[model samples]
Target chain A: MLQNFIFNYIDCPGIQSKNAGKVSTCAGCPNQSVCSLSSTKLANPEIVLVHKRLSLVKYKIIILSGKGGVGKSTITSLISRTIASENENKNVAILDIDICGPSQPRVLGALGEQVHQSASGWSPVYIEDNLSLMSIGFLLNNSSDAIIWRGPKKNGIIKQFLSEVDWGSLDYLILDTPPGTSDEHMSAATYLKEADITGAIIVTTPQEVALIDVRKEIDFCKKVNIPILGLIENMNIFICPKCKNSAEIFPALTGGAKQMSEDLNVELLGCLPLDPLLARCCDEGKNALIEIPNSPAILILKTIVQSNNFQLYIFLFSVSSLYKFNNINYLKLYQEYF
Target chain B: MLESVKHVFLVLSGKGGVGKSTVSSQVALALKESGFKVGLLDIDLCGPSIPYLLDLEVEDVHQSSEGWVPVFADSEQKLAVMSIGFLLKNRNDSIVWRGPKKTSMIKQFLTDVVWQDIDYLIIDTPPGTSDEHITVMENLRNVKCDGAIVITTPQAVSVDDVLKEITFCRKTGIPIVGIVENMSGFVCPSCSECTNIFSSNGGVSLSEMVNVPFITKVPIDPTIGKLELRGHSILKMYPDSEMSKAFSKIVLEITKSKEA
Candidate 1:
């Protein structure tokens, strides 16, 4: 049945036939067995539990990229912050699944905040009235201690992050994934298999080296059947705050994200310029979009969230319009709603 | 696995995109240029930029009865390179692995790869003193590491991270090979005039404060990125370039330290 679907429906250029050799997409595809190739492990029951836990959340969006230091965590934080600021009463949670480099704590301004475990599960640290956060960084003894567990242990914690976390009826759950498409991406996609992901926002810099890796990241998404929400070209240019003259800090040798997105057939969500104030905000563990309200980066992010076709935006819009729950027992309201 | 290897120099940085991989690949190439058998192992399981920087992306590892054989830099040189990038399903696919899987992969890269008798082994590690660094340090406990060369940009943020990296090496008992202040200044492409972009001498001041050898300052060369994009060695692309000269000086200093 899968082979038939591959031969007839799937238009992947790499997939010549059902019996053809495994291509790049085939390695991560759920239907790899239809092509008679075996590499990654198939999904199991833990995903079902993850779905049950995540079902309370209205939308799940993952921020991904092939290259590191492309401001993925920052984007995720910005998106969550933007969504939350739009409605003071709406509930939003950002899950920092970037295990190795859990910069969300630093980025989200929740550093040194501890994750408290009750009989129910681990409770996320509340950052604002509407925004809450869960991260492995919260479980660490210190910021510097290395998280050295292998696959099984890491999988255990990821499962725990999904199934055990008391997320409690969030309007949106923004997952900040680590750079690359290997374990965390696979695990998150697998666990949330039942719960439909809004899509992945692939971030990249305006550099050929960075864009080259992002292309493969797109391919990974295609293979795994993860819907590509759009591609965000971050740090595209450095706009001088003084003279307002623009400079290309990391110049694109080849046409960067815009050209690559056109080639890959993905939506170019928005391009964010390098703002010094924004960088300082991130360093100081403050909300960049909120701190510098008129910053171009924040404006671009707001436009992406407020996009006409974006379902999450509509969902958030409708929720805020219906309920004026701002500070009036918001946790209780969430409990009552769920 | 690298018992036959004479010296191991681990290239590390506290922060990402500080040109740790660039320094690693060039140092290995520089050593090979000096007629020494060198092997570059990229233990940065998360972001293996070594293979990409070295232009060995398509080369697959050959497994023998003994172990996995690393790809040679060129037929003319004795530089062998191994990175997790080569093992990916695609160039853009993320490794997405956790700590344990990454450590295992690092261990396999160290012990399983057929690294024969070589003069120097340069291991390019991922940024941060996290799981990957801990795993490499624990696994290579038996091997004789010459020291670690921490690469950093001439920025306070980058320099601060390098201090943490220095602390990690000290805590783990790894010798400090010295620090390379990469992108110390911007060298004009047309005029060859130098400009302090992130403010030069941050690394020098850091070295002085930390009490470690300050290796060499590699200026920002625009061609370095263009050359890396084309998968060519910087030294081979622009041998007389200021960046190549800086790397050569650093290599000379490293070798002199090793001998001493």
Candidate 2:
């Protein structure tokens, strides 16, 4: 349902753009080496389909963390659930492109749910009436089965997830990516370059090792020109339920995310503590906002979504007028890094 | 380094930030502490934390007649280390390489890298089962791959990913040596009381579900970070700590012969 002319081809010089490797717009593009000769040469054939399918989505937010296990899927699930619950009228969906270790189905409590296929496309499993989730988890025979795929196979699956899933007229499409700036991240970025990407929300723990990877992730975003919304520091501290005290679980040796954000000049949205209750709720796939409404982690998340100062609340059911959607000016500042 | 290296244990995880590199370093250090020559090959090229974890100084990969020479972690030249971390001109250089580049790099690492006949080669992989993992498995298909030691945290999310990893091991024919549940609980520095901040037994249940050996549970000890920061021997300096004891148990199990 995308307008055929929405995709502006000024940046890319078509398929025969001499060498895509030399083009700044083609940097970090998965098709940098092989730009297939096809329809109009505006983009790749699959990417054109991707644009056609995802043009209905208003905001496409990517949840990325170069370092894994820092709660990328957890935060994506929570945000989609929160957005859907906060606004009853809006339609929100999560597209989990983590082909190898897709956990969105399990995280959203929709494990073992099958994605039905109609004439249009594959239907994402509905976690709630307005909130739906799609992942390779739903397609596997067993939830425990491994997807032992190499690069091309993984890229194929990612394309199907982006263009084939019938995420009909979504207000927000949150994409949960795998760790590292590898196949999945590049494919998603390249295919969705012109999909009116709202921005990316980078997640990380407070540890220096984790932050080091996060810096790589920032570089990747700049190389791909994905405008970053801000950074969310996850698992900042561990608060004990029994002793009523807190501890530095990962121990931010190098001033943690705060210092990194200050040095890198990226917006620090807020920090969420390591709450046991929230972990238990996520383990059971229960709604954190409902199960542990008063927990510190949820309170911080609520503040992030409710506060007007920070940018997270802007993605919420805010007014449509104050808009500077993919301002190319911001990406130019990081072009030197590319 | 020994003349006849025996075991090559791959410390793996399905999710990131679950301390895969830390666990790999601990296991390798434990083997070295036990007087076994060890070679730690860190294939997590994107974020090779091994050099930092082992407190290795920034050094170049010198190409010898055999292949690239690995750096030594100890003065005794017992523990050898190779990582993409050492090849970078700048430590902050982001490895934004694609799959083909990564696969070729990994192939070069496996074919090259003068391990010098160490008793063990611990390959620390990046999270997930992608090209890097497949390339590793394919290249090691001919070798006597000992087994894989899977690492997971107590969180259900981590447990969920571990299940898929177990499947990957099963499909790849890598015997599951055991599973180590890392960061099971946080020990308050002041009160010394442990709390299940991540919720315990997820690793235990995962191991049980897959019928793999549940190695041990490592709790949150901030001192481990200090040891890692100072590049101190994890098992040697913190032998009395709970983490050291847990890894000692893991090393014991992973080092056992297949016939045993």
What is the lDDT of every predicted structure here?
0.75, 0.81
- True interface contacts retained by model 2: 0.72
List clashing residue pairs in candidate 2. A68-B16, A69-B16
lDDT of 1 at B63: 90
User: How accurate locally is residue B103 in candidate 2, as Cα lDDT from 0 to 100?
Assistant: 95
Query: Candidate 2 — which residues are off by over 4 angstroms?
Result: A1-15, A18-40, A309-338, B1-4, B227-229, B258-260
Per residue, candidate 1 scores C-alpha lDDT tens digits across B144-250 of: 88899988877554565577678788888999978899877654444445556555687999899889988889986667777443445567768898888898888
Q: Write the per-residue lDDT of candidate 1 for residues A69-147, one digit (tens) a residue.
A: 6788778888888889888877999988866657778777777899888988889999888999999988877665555
Q: Count the backbone clashes (under 3 Å) in each candidate.
A: 11, 2
Alpha carbon lDDT at B25, candidate 2 = 87
Off by over 4 Å in 1: A1-49, A240-245, A311-338, B44-47, B58-69, B84-108, B111-117, B127-135, B152-172, B179-221, B228-253
Deviation in Å, model 2, residue A231 alpha carbon: 0.6
Name the 10 consecutive residues with the lowest summed lDDT in model 1 chain B: B186-195
Most lDDT-accurate candidate: 2
